[model samples]
Structure formats: C-alpha cells, structure tokens
Target: MHLQEWLQLLCSHTGLKGSESEDLWSLLPSLPSFSLSTSSLLGLGALASLTAYWLVTRPRPMHPPCDLQAQSVAINGDPNCRRSALLKDENLLEFYYDDIRTAYDMFQRGVKITGNGPCLGFRKPGQPYEWISYTEVAQKAQWLGCGLIAKGCQLNTQQFIGIFAQNRPEWIITEVACYTYSMVLVPLYDTLGMEAMVHITNLAEMTVVICDREERATSLLENKEKGLTPKISCLVLFTDFSQAFAERAGKCEVEVLKLEQILDLGRQNLKDPVPPQPQDLAVVCFTSGTTGKPKGAMITHGNIASNASSVIKILEGSFTFQQGDVSISYLPLAHMFERMIQLSLFTFGARVGFYQGDITLLMDDMKTLKPTFFPVVPRILNRIYDKILGSVTSPFGRALLHFAVRRKQAELRSGIMRNNSLWDKLVFNKIQASLGGNLRFALTASAPISSTVLSFLRATLGCLIFEGYGQTECTGGCTFSLPGDASTGHVGAPLPCAMVRLEDIPDMNYFAKNRQGEICVRGPSVFKGYLKDPEKTAEALDSDGWLHTGDVGQWLPNGTLRIIDRKKNIFKLSQGEYIAPEKIENIYVRSVPVFQVFVHGDSLQSYLIGIVVPDREVFVDWAKEQGFVGSYQELCQNPDVKNAVLEDMRAVGKEAGLKSFEQVKDLYLHPDMFSVANGLLTPTLKSRRTDIQKVFQQQLSSMYNKTAS
Candidate 1:
C-alpha cells in the first residue's frame, strides 16, 4: 500500500491521531500530515514496520548514464596509472551538475538543501568543536552583509574591504558577506609584518578594515596617521581593544565598529539580498614581488567558481562527498589553495572545521573533530610521519612495519592486489584509529611530496593522497593527481578548466616539443592580471592571456606534468615560503659591508645560504675593534670574525624589513669579490645566478651540512 494510505489505515484503526481515538493532548496544535505532540504516541510496532519498509524500498547507489564522447587521458612513465576518463559529467553528483551562477547563490542553495545540517564546525580554547548548522551560517552571513552596507561602507566595486585576521569561521563569514555586497576582499596574511599590511591596504584602496585583533587595527590606523595612507573611514574589530592599541585607537580619526554592534545594526536588513555578479571582482590577493613590493592579483567571482567547477568535473566519482563528512582545515585562508577547497567542500555540504591558532594543537583538534578530509602541506605530513616513527618501540616492531610497508608498496606498484592486506588489520589499523578511523583522503600542494612518505601514509591510514600543481594565479589547481594514480616524479594530468603548454626557455635548455619548458597556463582560472601594474600584467599575461609561470616542467609518459626546475630565481622552501635570492641580495649588499653577495636556496631545504665578499676597509676596522691582529684574509678565515659578520648581516636584513623566512640563516665569507672578469657577473654588473651557484658549490654544500649537523 502507498505510504499515505498505510498511515491513514493505521491511524483509523489505532485511533492514534483520529478524533475517535483517545486524545493524547487535546491542546496541541494540529497539522495535516501528522502530529508530533508526543513521541510515545507512535507505537514501536508502527515504527518498526515503517523502518523495515523504508530500508528495503530505498534505491541502491546508482551510476549515471554513460557519456559516449568521453576520451582517455594518458600519463607517460607510470604503467600502474589507469587511463583517466575524459570530460565526463554524467558520473558527477547532483551538486556538480548545477551551473553555479555565483558563490553566494550556491551558498544559499546549500542552506536550503541541507536544512539543519552542519555546514561549519568551530571550536574554542579548551573546548570541543560544536557544529554550526547551515541555517545559522546563511542567517549570519546575511546579517553581516546588511551590517556592512548599513555602515559607511558601500556595496560596489569602489569599496575594498581589508580582512586582516586568522583562519576562522568569521573569516569565511566575512568572505561570504563580501560576495553578497559586491565588495572586493583584500586578504592580508595575519602574521605578515607591518610594511606589507600598509602596502597592500594602500594599493587596494581599502575603505573599511575588518580585523580580528587590536594590533592589526592599530597598524592600519597608524599608517593613516603617518600619512602613508590617504584615509580609512571605518575599522571593524572582531576582538576587544587592548591597552596596547587603546591610546592609538583614541587618537585615530577613523570610526570604530564592533563586530557585534554591526550584527545588531544588521538585524533590520534580513530581506536585502543583493549578490555579486560573476564578472565582478571578488578578491585582490597580493603576492610578494621579487622587487620587495607586493603585487595584487585580481581574482574575479567567475574565475574562482569556474576553477572549482572544473576540479569537480575532472574528479567526479573518484572523490565523493557525503553529507556530514568532516573536513579539518589547517592551512591559512589568505592563500587560494585552502580558500577554494573550502568553498568546493562547502557547496557539497561537508562539515569544515578550522584549526585553532596554535599549530601544535592540530592533532588535538583532529582527535576531537574526527575529520574525514584533510588538506595538508608536505611539512604537516612529515611531522605525522615523525610522530609515528617515534612511537614504534622495539627493533622487532620496526622490522614488522618495514615489511608491511614494503608489501603494500609492491602491491601498489604491480597494481595486482586492490584489497586491504593483513598488515592493516594487525598493525596499520592503529594509525587509522588514532585519526578516528575515518580519514579517507588528503590533498597536498605548494611543494612536491616524497614518494616513500606518500606510500607509507596511504598504507598506514588507508587514505588516498592527491598532490596538485598550480600557482595562486591558477586558482589553486591546474593539474591534480587522481585516485589510484600513484605515479612517480610528476604531479598529475591537467584539468579541463585550463590548458597547459610548455613554452621554450632556451637559456634553461628546455623546449616545448621535448615535452618540457616554461609551464604556461591559459583559461578561466587565470587571474585577470596584476592589479594596477599594467607593465607586469603585460609581461605575465600577454595579448593571448597565457600566464607565464616561469617554472620549468616536463611531461610524463601518460601525459602528466612534472616540475623539473624553476627558470625564475624565486623558489619555495620546504616550509612553503617563497625566497627570491636576488631580492635578498639587493637588500643586504646595500647595507652590510659586502662588496658582493650571492644567495642560494634549495626548495627541499628549510633555510638560506649566503656567499659574501666583505669590504676590505670595513672588515679590517671591525676585526681591529674585536682585537683580531691579522691580515684581512686571515681575519676572514677566523670563525669569530665570521660570527660577527653574520650578526651584522642579520641586522641589515632586519632593518631592510625582510621576514624571517627570507633572511639568510648561514653565510660563507670569502676574500675574493665577484667581478665581471671572474665570470661571476655579466658586463652589465648583474650577477650570473647559475655561474655564481657553480662557483660557490662547495661553500654552499658546507653551509647546508653545518646546519644539518
């Protein structure tokens, strides 16, 4: 019988909801479908019958109709890699099929579809995380948008809102509010020093600043008072004003608005829902330039939305997101990698938990949160590996783990055994249990991961590790490693959203037809250009709109891409900090008593190395003051003199406003200076980077080993 018919007959016979039946509560309000006045009124027999029928009658998990036009994508070297399926949307879930018009629109739709469902999970210090339902996020975002408009802040392209805060629920809420009001979001890294904060805000022409702490607010207002910035009208502080900045706050001309005050002011604006168009600028993200100035990348709403859509299309059924799936986010939202992934997961109704401010507490947060999805960097994964290795006790236990790891590695390489092994049940299961036994997948970016580490994590936690390749300009992902594609060397195949082609860089000995060159990308994911810097915009984004990534790449046998080298001098350190050697050298040579300086770095290494040629007079004077009775060459060889020079160099870097990651950690003082005659510098007085690296190869090696030891 039909559900309605069955209900009607049951009610009529039992007199549970009928007028003739004994009334459980006569004063209760009535509804047409059923009465929820009391749970005891519904008998166990009725509930059991209903549950049994529902379970048996529910539809099985089904695959969508096949697409005849789908093609195969190949990766060259790895035979274990399965031939990837083509542009096949049929296999995608219902969420992927929707043509997401705007970010705000998708957010509201998510709210309606997932009623009372957890969209965001937040935790306080010394407390467990509590789920914030979709309704609450939507309501709060709406109110926040209204509050923004109610203030002097305008809801148009002319208005730029600076978000100077850590990664938290409030950050996401502020982003959503920006989308609704069509205001451009200028994200400043919370730990970014004062100069960058002042530079970015002034360049973006931010009218209102929504910051989490008083120090940041004071920094912005102080910059204004110093005449570095023209004028900022409003300051929205998320935290209380501390005594540290209270004096500055009182003297500042800008009006202060509390977050709660804005919310209350927005209570009257629930119905004003003006969302941004796809073409409108959503963000002006500033990336550090090699010249010590920050250049803002203008990312539009369509750029971000399209990039997310393309990723979902390529990864369809390979990665599935069920409702209530918990995702623990540890990366900062100021960067595009974490920001775009958060939005994509949100659209599919996953519960996203933001990590607390302290990174050491990440494991504790994960234990309490029990996350199924984790977005990580290589450092985080390496730390977890270290922890696991430390926990292994006896030699016998270590041998067993090694054997199990080898067995799993062989099985994966051969593509023979797809089932879980006995090791998982006997030993590896403990790692899974520690992570709440639910970590299904993890995504890593910014740098390449060790294949050994990758295999160990896959075997230990039973989770797929997907590593991707892209710049901030590409909206976080251009090529993505697929499930079961444990290919070596290369990251993965290109997504349909962007077309990647290798352009010739003859100076670096790479060419396009050889299947390797400068990695250039062109698509909807590419940023419009560097904000307000048309010259740089022209150089990076030409007439055809292809972004010159400046990183050398090669294609694998199966059509995947690998970064072989970087033609550009800038490289990322192990901790994901970008270090431009030339930029550092320029700042140091001007202040330090150095005739010439050559900076070198390894992406797989944590710190920087400096090769210096100290000035003759300054070096002798400093040595004499320190009572070093020797010639300049002898003084240069002295360890004590080297330490003093290193301290002086560090002071130069500090005064020049370089961040800790950008500063030189170690140095080698040589008596000989770099000159054009020595083949280290060109006739134009530019230091030949490759030549310098080769000349001081031994010195660089010694410096690296000193820190390692």
Candidate 2:
C-alpha cells in the first residue's frame, strides 16, 4: 500500500479525523520524549528525513553487474594479450554434456532428458504448429542414418553427405543422421550459385545429395548433364518424386528415391550405429567466398562441441536454456551462426520452429510460436527499428518516444528491467508486441549493429540483447557481450574456449601495443583447417594456431572488443588517403532511401562513388510525396530522384562524421539490389565487392569519368 493509504488507514482505526490526526502529530513534538534542545531535535528530524528518502529512492538493480575490471586477464605479463575470465591457465572449456561429444550425441542426450517433449515444429497453411517429439526424432534419425548406409554410403568419417535446401525438419534430420553415421555434412544453399555448388560437391567428393524441393534435385541432374558433377550418383528427395522424374534420374545414370522409401529400407535392414569420435570430421562448412571461391572449413566433432559447450557455460549463469524455451529458425541454416544456435538448443532439449521457407513470414511465425529466445541479424533489427520509429508520425509523439526511451535507458544503467512501467505501457508496449511479446533474450550477430538501435531495442523489448562476434572458421562465436552489460559499440570479451589477441597490422597503422590491430582467435573451437587448401589454411592459422581475423579491432579499457575497420576491404585514393568503403557503406545504408549500398573508391580518383539500391517501399512512398509519378524502374533512372537520394546519403554521412573524401559524391541508383541470389552478396549478406563492381562496371566507369571531368 502507498504511504498515504497507510496513513489514512491508521487514522480510521484510531477514530481520528484529518484535523485530529494533525493535532496529534503537532503534540508529538511537545511530548516528553521530544522535550530536547532545539538543535538536537532538528538534527534527529534531518536524519529521519534523510533515512526515509534513502530507503525510497535507492537503486534496486535486478541483475548483477558485469565485472568489467576482471573481464579478461593479461597473458604472460603482456597487457596487450588477453584470455577469457572463465579460463584457468589457457585450458579449454569442457563440453556441457559430460559424455556428449558430437551433434548426434546431443540428440540422444535430449531424448533421454526431454523424452516426449517437442523437438521440432512445423506449420501447415491452415493449421497450427505440429511438433515431432524428441523420441520420434531420434527414431527417424536412426532410420535415416541406416538407410543411407544401406544405399551404398560409406560408414566412415570421410563420407560426405550434401544437403542443398532451405531450413526444415528434414534439413536438421539429415544433419543429425550424417553425424550419427560418422559422415561429414556439407550444407549448400541457393545463394552459393551453380558453380560453387558443383565445386563444393566435387571438392568434398560427395556421392549423394539430399534436397527438399524438386527443382533442386533436377538441378543436380542438369548439372550432371553439363558434365560439372560427374561423381554424384544418387539424389534423395525429402518431398515426393514423380515417376517421370524417377525415369529422368535413371536415364541420367543417377538413382532417385523419396524419404519414405529410404526409411522403409532402413526399417528392413537395420544396422548398428557408427558414432563419430571427438577427432572425427563432422562438417565441411564452406565459406561464402566474399573474396574468391568457396573453401570448405573442416570442422571436427570436438571443434563444434567445444564451441557450443563454451557458449552455454558462459550464458548459463545469466540466461539458462530450459526445456520450455522456444526459438524461431529463420536465418539460413547454412550459416554457422544459426547452426551453432540450433546445436546449443538441442543440447538443452529446447524446441525449434522453422519458418515456412519464407523470410517475409518471419513475424507471422514469431506470433504463432511466441518464442522466448530470438536469434536475429542486424538487418532484421534495423528494419524493425525503422518501422517502429516511422509509425510515430508527429513531432511531439516522436519527442515523447525519445524521452521515454531515455528514461528506460537510465533505469537499464541502474540494472533495472521492467515492462510494466508507465512509459513501456504507453509508448513501447505496441512495439514489443510486434515481436510476439515474449522475447526474453536475443542475440544479434553477422554484422555490427548501431549503438542507437541496440540500446533502443534493449529498453523497448525488455530483453537482454547480446551482441556477438565470430567467423565460420571459429565454429560460430568467439566473443559475446555480457548479459547485464548496457554499454554499446563492443562485442564483449572472449568465450572460455577462445583466447583472443591482437596482431600488428603495420600497413594499417594498427599496433598490438596500442590495443588496436587485427583480431586473432586461438582455442579448441577453431576449425581443424581448410579442407583441400593447405595454402589458405596456413594463411588463416599461423604456426601457433592463432586464426588471423582480417578485421581490425580495438580493445576497450574494460576488455571488450570494438570493431574499427575492415583491414582487407580498405583501399587508397589518389591523394594517398585510405578509404574504408564498408564503414562508409554502413553509414549510408542508414539513409531512408537506401536498402543496400556499395561504396566504391578508385585509387586513381580523388573522390568516391556508390551504387545504391533504394528500398522499394520507402523510395516509392517518398517519390509520391514529392509529386513524382513513374514506375519503380523509371523512378530509379530519374536523375532528380538519384540526386535526391545522393543528397540524403550525404546528409547521413555528414551526421555520422565521415570525412569529405570518404563520402560518396557521385551515385548510380540501381533498381536491382545486390543479393546472394544475384551472386553479388555472400550468404552471410556481406557484399562480394569484386562481383558487385563487375556487375556495375559500366555505370561505375561513367560516374568516375563524370566526376573526373
């Protein structure tokens, strides 16, 4: 009860009205116990008032503060080198499950623990989500593993099983089955292109390919006809195959079978499982190849197992994974970040719901599942941030929104997190409801998110938004921001299995002594090596086992890591001023019109140019507001629209404090976007700069010539 309510109740029980209560209060000062010197009475009253205020206004933190001072310890008296606080003398973290060493082992443990609990979920067009229990999943995976063995797949660690499809129950089932039978799993997606797919298949010497759709299966046969993949002898379809398609496969000298057929074969001829050892090869995760051809990174069972276990150990104290926890799987399963998340969930027997193979329906899926754990990328978060801010059309409402955010952010710094506050109910409740209103935790990776967006989401969503940093070669994540950390612009300290240090990048003017240089990670979670490429392996992993990450970073005083620039993606202008296009592109993409931006600078030129793909909806809306009428393509080509977008980009750049030379002075607004499907972006959404430049060579040349003149 409130203080006023208590006082009123006391007065009613004592049979005293307001005036009578005031008289009693007035008499207390003149009572015998209060008959003291005036100075003594005044000092007692002051102390009581101070005590009451302190009791009412003191901070009530909800979670423990991150020990920033002890975040990492220097190694061998070198302040520049560091390791995780959880580590002891550089020893790697053990697996979360004592006996579980591989991904398949994790499923078995889940079956033993969660039993009939839902493991995988899917939704039909008009139905709610249907779930497959852990026991059922285990049985299906067993049958599938034996079926592959019966179908002439070698039961050994070197046997490569390729999966080329979107994320689904079948995709994960294939992955678990491959690990169950001591086979290496190679994941391929549409973004890899036909040439890269064929190259991966041949490089892995994969004899069988499993797919979800008919087009994917047909493409394999078509590629065979083109003499690209001669070794692939079998095609397994998760969906049904028509007799005509079976005949077509037979004519192409390839065997085709449905999923049910394989399960039946396995049921008829059940064999003992051949589990993989810790050192056995588990996956040949291929890089998306932003610079060159996709190279397979050989990940052993122990590598991924240790990585997942280390991550879980670090998070368990703050956000423990439980059986009832649910997550939406929408990010490409082909990416290591998503794969690691799924693996971690499996270890804890959590449920995973797959999207309907459509990213546009992700919010629909989230509403249906009401997931508690949300794993996202920065692109999705940025869109959500923009959409919510765009909804408040009035200046006063926007101002109020900003003010509310500031208030909540102040509470966040005091370690308080609550959603029932006045501001949360009035201003941010609807914003939270858009994400299913049950997001207890979220991890944003794959790219750096702005501090404004991160802090805003933390306050509005009422969840711990952890920022993580890693690469495919490190088996997913190496560093993750702490749970209670409110600071932004850093990826936090290293995980227990990862010991990070900086190496001098002399050309970039970054030095280890200055706590700024190329980030290098060394640990048990690092990949064994690049498959079939000794030169690249040697380049990535030095003799001391440190994986040299090409990104430049600075170690903050508190031991967190802040990404500064792209060491490998930087270029020099004619005036010898170095330009980092990625940093500029990141800033320019924040403009309302731009959806994707490719900032380009020529060493022969003094200024930069950009190829911008305007956000279709926002750009069209803006054009209509300006009294302009044209088709989407026509609007893109309109010189006035192009100039307006360029000006907006310049405004954003100026706000971000970009150098004059770094800002793009000329721009070509393209109607088409740089995407993975177009082979202009990697699967991770990083720009394939060489391919993008190739695609717009003529336009780039025109822009440069005009700027030069």
Best by lDDT: 2
Candidate 1 deviant stretches above 4 angstroms:
1-85, 88-96, 242-247, 288-291, 411-421, 570-709
Please give the lDDT score for candidate 2: 0.84
TM-score of 1: 0.70
Count of steric clashes across candidates, in order: 9, 0
Q: Write the per-residue lDDT of candidate 1 for residues 1-709, one digit (tens) a residue.
A: 3334444565555435433222323322352444433343456446835644554443222222122122224334332222334544323111344567567766766776797898887788879898778888877777887888887678786688889887788888888888877888888864345776777877788778889988777778878888777667788888888664655655666777778888888887654777787778888877633345667888887778877786677656656766767888777777788888888877787789978877778877888888988888764675577567667869999999888878866655543222246777887887877776778778887765656567787667766677888877877777776555655666776666666767887654577667778888777778888888898899888788888887778867666777766667767799887776765775676543565678889988998988888876466766787677688899889888888877778898898688898888888989997754565653224466776788889999999998999
Pairs that clash in candidate 1:
74-558, 75-557, 75-558, 75-559, 76-556, 76-557, 76-558, 76-559, 77-557
Q: Which lDDT values do the candidates have, in the order given?
A: 0.72, 0.84
Compose the digit string of candidate 2's lDDT tens values, residues 126-238: 56888999888878888988999988999998899999888889888889888878999999888777888889989998889999978898888898878899899889899
- Compared with the true structure, the alpha-carbon lDDT of candidate 1 equals 0.72
Candidate 2: which stretches are off by over 4 Å?
Answer: 1-66, 620-635
